[model samples]
Target: MLNSFDQKKQKILQEIQSDDLDLSPKGTIDELCIPIINLINSNDDMVTTSSCSGRVSVYLEGTKSNRAVVSKGNHGRWLFVTHEPHDLKDWTSKINFVYTSSFPDPNARLILYKFEPLILHVKCRNLETANKLYQVAMNNGFRESGIGSNFNVAIRISIKLDIPIGYKSPKDEEFEEDILNLFVTKDYIKYIDQLSLERFEENSKKLNQLYKAIEKDLSNGTVLTIKTNKPNWESKEERRRRMVKEGLKRQEELRELKQDQIQ
Candidate 1:
C-alpha cells in the first residue's frame, strides 16, 4: 500500500498527464522548460505545480492613482505577448494602433514591454525534500529560489527586462501621435526588443544549468533525455548568437574530458 505522500504525488502527476485539468490559456507545458519539469517529476518526492520558460510582452496598464494601491489582472490587458524572442517588425506593426485606435478603456495610462525570466513551482513530499531541492536550484543559477513550510519550492531566476514603451497624461482625453511616437519610435522599439532577447538568452542558460543540476542531484537518473529547442521561434541574429554560445560550450566540455582522461 502506498503512503499518503506517495498517493499525493501519484495524483498530481496523473493530473499533469491527463491534459484535461489545465485551465491555462496556453493549456500546455513550456517547450524549453520541459526537460527540467520532467526531471523534477521523475523524483518520487516532487511534483511541479507550474513552470514558465520565459516571455516577452507588451501590456496596457490601467490608470494609476497615488492614493490607491497597485493591482493587476490580465484579460484585455496584454496587447502583445510571446514565449520566444520576437523580430522587431512584430512589435512595430502594432505601433500605429497605439494612438490611432479607438480603445475600449479610456483609463489606460501606459504601454510597456517586459521580459520575465523562468519560474517554477514544485510541491515536495516533505519539508526536507523541498529544502534540498531549493538548495540545489539556488546553487545552479536560480539564486532567487525559495522554500516554504508547506513543502513548496519555487525556482525564481533574476534575468529580466521592464521598460516603458509609451504613456499618456491622465488629464488628456487622447495622447497626441507626435508625443507617443517620440517614446515608442521604430528605432527605440527595436532597441528594447533586442535587449530583451539578450536577456532571454541568459535566461535559457540559467534554466538549462538548473535543470542539469537537478537531474544530477535529485532525479535518480530516471529523467528522460528531452531535446528542448524551438528553432522556428528564434530570430536570425538570436540564432547566430546561440549557436556561437553552444560552440564555446562544446569546446569547454571537450577540454574538461581531456583533463579527466589525463587524471
Candidate 2:
C-alpha cells in the first residue's frame, strides 16, 4: 500500500538510525529535541556546530490565563506533559512549574503514550531468504514505523482492533473484558506489539525448515510455517472459556429480566 516515495523515506529513515545507532543512548533521544538542537547547532549540512557539549539553558513557558503546567522544554522545543500538578515529583515538578503557571488538576484526564518493544528472534536458511520474508511482511499491512529510536517496527494492527461493538448493557465488567480482548488479538500481538520481527522472522524461517523436516506430524501435512508469534495462544484459549461463561451469565440475566416483565 505504501508508494515508492514511502519506500524511499523508509530507507532514508533507516539511514538516520541504523542498528548501531539504536543501541546508543544519544541515538534514542527525543525526536522533538533533536530538531530544536539541530536548528541552534547544525549548519547547512545538518551537522551540529555546538562548541561545548555540556548542559544547555532550557526555557519553559507557562499558559497565560489559568497558568497550569502544560508544557516543558525539551532539547529546545516545548513538550506537553499529561500528568497533573500533584502527580509531578522532583525535577519534573520544578520543570512543571517553570513551564506553565496553570498546573493540571488532580481530576484532569490524561492519556499516557509509551513505546512497547516487540522482539523476534528468527532463524532461516540464508540472508537472501530472510530478505524475502521481510519483503512479504511489508506487502501485508505492516507499516515501517518504529518504536522510539528502535528500528523494530510497531504493529498498528493491535491498536486498530480495539474498537467497541454492539449495544451498551448494564454489565460493565463484562463489557470491559470484551473491550480488552479486542485490543490483544493474536494478529495484533503476533505481528505488531510484543514480538520482535527481525529475530522472530529468522526463527520462523528456521521453524518452517523444521516443520518441513516432519511434515507428517503436522496437522495440515505441510512443512511451511509463517513467522507469526503465538503470544495469544493461551489467552485465546482462555477467551473461549470466558465466552462460554459470559454466555451463560447473560442467558440467566435475560431470563430473569423476561420473568420480571411477564409478572
Candidate 3:
C-alpha cells in the first residue's frame, strides 16, 4: 500500500505529465526548471511540489480591492510575464498598459516590473531528509530556504525585484499607452528590461548551484560535482529490497573475507 507521501508524489508526477492541467499562471512548468525538478523527484526521499525557473514580469496591482486587503502579497495580477530574459520589444507591441484610477494618491495603485528568482517547494520522506535538503540548499546560496519540523523544505532565492513602473486603475482595467507614456519613457522601460535580464542570469546560476549540490548530497552524502545528465531513478522500496537480497548472497562471501583477512 502506498503511504501518504508516495500517493502525493505520484499525483504530483502525474500532474507534470499531464498537458491538461493548469495549476499556475504559467499554465505549466518552466522548461529551464525541468531538469532541477526532475532531479529532486528522481530521488527516493524527495519530490518537488512546485517550482519556477525565475521570471521577468509586468504586474498590475489593485490597491483598493477587497482581494488586495485579503492577500497583501498577491494583491495583483500579471499584465505580462516571461520565464526567459524579457525583451521590451516583444512586450511593448503586445501589451498596452492601461489605467483608469482617479484616486487622491498617484501611488494608490501600481504597475510593476519584476525579476524573480528560483522558487521551489519540496516534500521529503522524513524530517531528516527535509533537513538534509535544507542544509544543502542554504550552502548553495538559497538563503531563504527553510525546513519545518515535519517533512517539507521550501527553497527560495534572496534576490527579487518589485520595481514600480506606473499606476493602474484599482476599479477599471483599461486606460491607454498615453497614460503610461506620460510618466515612463521608452528608454526607462528598456533600462528595466536590461536590469531584469541580469537578474534572470543570476537566478539561473543560483538554481544550478542548488540542484548540483542536492544531487551530490543525494548520491553519496559527500563529494560534490556538477552533473551533466539525468540519473536513472529507483524507488526506495525497490532499493531496500535489492540491498536485502544482495546481503543474503554476500553473507557467506563476507565470512570468507573476514577469515582470509585474519589469516
User: Candidates' lDDT values, in order?
Assistant: 0.66, 0.28, 0.66
lDDT of 1: 0.66
Candidate 2 lDDT score at position 155: 22
lDDT of 1 by residue, 1-263 (tens): 99887887777666765524244333455667777877887788888888888888776554454323222432124555667674435666755444433333434466777888899999998887898898998788788889965798888988877776665433334743322322555666677788888888888888878877887788866775422233246774675466445544554555465445423
| Candidate 3 runs further than 4 Å off | 63-75, 86-90, 97-107, 169-182, 220-263
TM-score of each: 0.71, 0.19, 0.72
* Cα lDDT for residue 229, candidate 2: 14
Error of 2 at 60 (Å): 25
RMSD of each: 14.3, 23.5, 18.4
Residue 246 in candidate 2 has what lDDT? 51
Candidate 2 local lDDT, 44-152, one digit each (tens): 1111111111111112232223434433221112122211122222222232121222324333322121222222222222344344333433344234422322122
Q: Worst 10-residue stretch by lDDT in candidate 3?
A: 223-232
Candidate order by TM-score, decreasing, is 3, 1, 2
